[model samples]
Target: MIRVLLVDDQTLVRAGFRSILDGEADIQVVAEAANGADAVRLTRELRPDVVLMDIRMPEVDGLEATRQVCADPRLSGVKVVILTTFDLDDYVYGALRAGASGFLLKDTEPSEMINGVRVVARGDALLAPSVTRRLIADVVSRGRRPEPSPRLNVLTAREREIIAVVAEGLSNDEIAARLVLSPATVKTHVSRIMTKLDARDRAQLVVLSYESGVVTPGWLS
Candidate 1:
């Protein structure tokens, strides 16, 4: 089962998410926190597989909470899915940089939200294509890119291309079709790339791809 912790300051929002997620047989809402402090405490204590975190909260806020959670070795298995009210919310970018696995608009469909939980639980990246595009644009607008790092030289030419496409928000199947390779082969390359880059998952790979300049923010468009 995928254990999830719901963290939001609003009682109704938490209740709403719990109501939607509780219906999934494979997912369990293991805990709820009204703010970032409680979220951090419950995460260390319960160590759920996924955290549905609200970006804005009283006191600690989701970005700092996510940073703390990601920093804790004890909670390394935990993946945070930030919740935001706006698609273009600037806080979403910081949350991602803070090691959140992904973000979800608060108005996401119930089915999509459930699927998102399962995706992240299985250790896949979960940014929507549109969101990914917007996020890259926002980062570029702010003049941020990966600094010069020797870590990038580890990837082969093909692996570099694959990582760049991944930052473009394409799935393995889509990438395979674009590159004229089988999906399984694409998956293998992605796995290898993750290992070489020491990325937590594809999301981090995407982040590194941009930061390393293998993929630029303008290339995302």
Candidate 2:
């Protein structure tokens, strides 16, 4: 079962998510928290596979909670998915940089939200193509320059190419079709790239791609 912890300041919001997610056979709503402090505490206790975190809270906001959770060596297997009211939430990028696997708009369709939980639970990023573009745009608008990492030197030419395509938000199948290779081949390349960069998942790979200068905002144009 994919265990999930729901963290939201609003009781109704947490109940809504629990109701939707509990109906899934593969998903279980293990616990709920009305604040970030409880969220982090419960997370350390339960160690759920996925955490649905709310950004704005009374004490210890989701961003800081996410930082605390992600930074914990014991919670490395846990994935945090930010729940926001807006698609381009100001806290989204910060949460991602702080080790959140992805963000889901609270108003997203029930089916999409369910699938998103499963995606992150299985160690995949919940970033869709449109979301990826908007995330990149947000970063660009912030006027942040590329802060390259020495880890880029470890990737091969083909791996670099794959990482760039991944930053474009293509799935393994799509990348395979574009590069005329099998899906398995593409998955392998992505895995290798993640290992080399020590990325937690595809989300971090995307962050690394931009932050490391392997992909720039101009590339999208």
Candidate 3:
């Protein structure tokens, strides 16, 4: 079963998510927390597969909690998914940088939310194409210029191209179509790229692609 921990300051919000997620036989809502402090505490104790976290809280916001959970060696298998009211939340990037696997708008469709939990629980990021565009726009607007990083030196020219396309938010199938390759081939390339960069998932690849200057913000336009 995919164990999940719900962390939200509002009782109603937590209840709503629990209700939607509990219906899935493959998922289980293990616990709930109203603050980040408790969220981190419960995470260490229960070690759920996924954490649905709220950004704004009374004490110890989701960003810090995510950092704590992700940074813990004992909690390495845990993934944190930020829950936000807006698609373009200001804290989304920080949360991602702090080791959050992805973010979901609180008002997202029930099906999408359920799938998102499953995605992150299975070690994939929840970065849909739309979310990736917005996230890149936000990073560009903040004047985050790409700089030289030797971490990407291990990648071949083809691998670089694959990573660039990945930053554009294309899935393996989409990338395969664009590159005139089989989906299996594209998936292999992506896996190789991730292994080279030590990226946790596709979201981190997007971040690294931009930060390492493999892809520029203007590519989006």
Tell me the TM-score of each prediction against the true structure.
0.92, 0.94, 0.91
Task: At residue 187, give the lDDT of candidate 1.
Answer: 95
Candidates by TM-score, descending order: 2, 1, 3
lDDT of model 3 at residue 188?
90
Q: Report how far off residue 43 is in candidate 2 (Å).
A: 0.9
Which portions of model 1 show Cα errors greater than 4 Å? 144-148
Query: Per-model C-alpha lDDT, please?
Result: 0.85, 0.87, 0.85
TM-score of 1: 0.92
Can you tell me which runs of candidate 2 are displaced by over 4 Å? 218-221
Q: Between candidates 1 and 2, which one is better according to TM-score?
A: 2
lDDT per residue, candidate 3, 1-221, as tens digits? 99999999999999999999999999999999999999999999999999999998987988889889888889988999999866446688888877788888888899999999988886667776475566656665576576878998898989988888888777788899999999899889988888888777777887787677877776656
Local error of candidate 1 at residue 132 (angstroms): 3.0
TM-score of 3: 0.91
List the candidates ranked by lDDT, beginning with the highest. 2, 1, 3
Error of 3 at 204 (Å): 1.1
Q: Highest lDDT: give the candidate number.
A: 2
Candidate 1 lowest-lDDT run of ten: 136-145
Write candidate 1's Cα lDDT for 53-167 as tens digits. Answer: 9978899999999999988888889999999876446787777777888888888899989999998998878865586667755675576555767897888889988988888
For TM-score, the strongest prediction is 2
